[model samples]
Target chain A: MDTRERLISSTRELLWERGYTGTSPKAIQERADVGQGSMYHHFRGKSDLALAAISRSAREMRDSADAVFTDTGTVVDRITAYLRRDRDALKGCPVGRLTQDPDVMADPELRRPVEETFAWLTDRLAGLLADGRTNGELDPRLDPEATATALVAVLQGGYVLARAAGSADVHARAVHGALGLLTGDARRSPSGQENR
Target chain B: MDTRERLISSTRELLWERGYTGTSPKAIQERADVGQGSMYHHFRGKSDLALAAISRSAREMRDSADAVFTDTGTVVDRITAYLRRDRDALKGCPVGRLTQDPDVMADPELRRPVEETFAWLTDRLAGLLADGRTNGELDPRLDPEATATALVAVLQGGYVLARAAGSADVHARAVHGALGLLTGDARRSPSGQENR
Candidate 1:
């Protein structure tokens, strides 16, 4: 990979693993195996590099969601596929994890991508739910905006539960719980593999 | 407060603000206005003191939930009270936040209280849900444990969204969303003050 690509990927990994405050420029350099001159040549500094990384992470998040969202299926089916997608549950969401970092939150430039990711996610999901309601697939009275927010929260919060317990089972259970509530049909959304 | 009490409280705040890896022994001593001798005399080290603070935080979490969970109301009503309770929404959950701290998650001792807090929370909510089912207050087919897990995740994930956006409104929205779903009544949960 080019030095810029290497630096951005390293920053992304560090941001996910250590957070903004915990991750250092020197660490980024070491991880990317690029010298300080190379890093500076590619970007202004740590914050600049982080922004690039975060924006990339946010784009990736939306892309993955859209992958399931735009697929051929009923709205509920698509939403379920997105929720149950294979993930490193214990490692947590790359974009969602940054919310806990004080440094990232203090800087709006740093926080923008994180905010945009969720905004876009909920907006996209809400649109899908609205389509379902219009087509008489979901309850007419369902509040798509609020329900969409809740669905996104379940995925983010499921990671929190999974990490706290040091087990992915709790995360899976949380997802199924949400699916049960949304679908109003537990039999169809049976709680699958505990550790998957 | 006593020296020991001061140390514990200070550690609790630091853990919440800075996390395990970010908080240092010197920082803790300075925050508590105690010297190294006093700090070491009161506890073994950062880990032991953190355990005490985390356990205290866990107890407080349960106490606050019980305050709502045990209130005289229908199961859904009690759950709603807990979800809608006023909070430092942007600051995130004290116990749940630790789940993101790598140092805390890596150590069994540090992680125990966090795990127990969530386990107790989900278990307690599950019991309340089961009661709702038995008493004909909720759907008989509802899976109490999974539903309980999802409810807790909403709260945890709500903080995530709130922090990311730098607004408590999203957290409140997520709460009402879940409440609406669980109760299947959105009108009763008319979206409240956006800033509240």
Candidate 2:
């Protein structure tokens, strides 16, 4: 990758690990293996670089969600696929993690990507649920928008539980529990059957 | 308050806003309105002060949970009360927020109070759920531990969603949605409930 791409990628990684307040421009340069001049050549400073990185990360997250939302399957199948998709459970959600950073939340420009990503996810999930209800695949009585918000909250909060306990097992259990709540009627066991 | 108490309270307030990485000894002293020598005289440094602050916060959170857990009421009533308790939702949960701080997580001493607080909450909630199940108040097949984790996750994740959206309405809606799911009943509209 070129220096500019390398710099953005490195910044994204650092931001995930150390957050905006903890990450330094020097650390980004070191991680990218680029000189100061090369970094400055591409972006104004840390904030400028972070805005680019966050925007890229947001796009990447949205694209991943879109893949699940548009999959040729039932709503449960698609949502199950999205939840059970390969994830670094211990690392937590990249976009969700930004919500906890005060510096990131303070800047409108820096916060836009994080805000937009979640808003988009909630809307997308709500649409999928609405589609399911329309097809009679889910209970028509279910409120799509509320259920979507609850579904996303479970994943984000599961990370907090896991990280606090220093165990990803808690997160996995929470996911299993939520999936059970969503698909309980189809299964005899408390743990829901794996989605085909 | 004594000097030591003043230092701890100041640290808690600052940690809530700035997090561990962004907080410094000089800033802490300035916020506490205590001299450098006075702070050092009471505690070794920022970390020491933070440890004391975290311990205090954890204790307060646990005590708050204990009140709900020990209340003589139905499990749903108690849980709802805990969920609806007044809070500065925008400020977020101090202990939950610390889980996102890399520096705080890295220090075992700093992380202990946070870990203990969540652990205690999980156990307390699980106990209540178990009681409900045994008394036929909850689903017999429900896993107390898993359900407790999900409840806690919902609350923590609700804060993140609310903060990101810049509205506590989403948080309240998410909480109500989870409660509805737990009860396995649709929420009645105000008029419908009154008529019933």
Best by DockQ: 1
Q: Could you estimate the TM-score for every candidate?
A: 0.97, 0.93
What does candidate 1's lDDT look like per residue over A1-196, in tens digits?
8889999999999999989888999999999999999899999999999999999999999998888999998988898898888888999999999999888998999999999999999999999988988888777777888888898999999999999989998888888988888877743445464766
**What DockQ class does candidate 2 belong to?**
medium
RMSD of 1: 1.3
Candidate 2 global TM-score? 0.93
Candidate 1 is scored at a TM of 0.97
Give the alpha-carbon lDDT of every model: 0.90, 0.81
Against the true structure, what is model 1's DockQ? 0.80
DockQ, per-model, please?
Answer: 0.80, 0.55
Worst 10 residues of 1 chain B by lDDT: B186-195
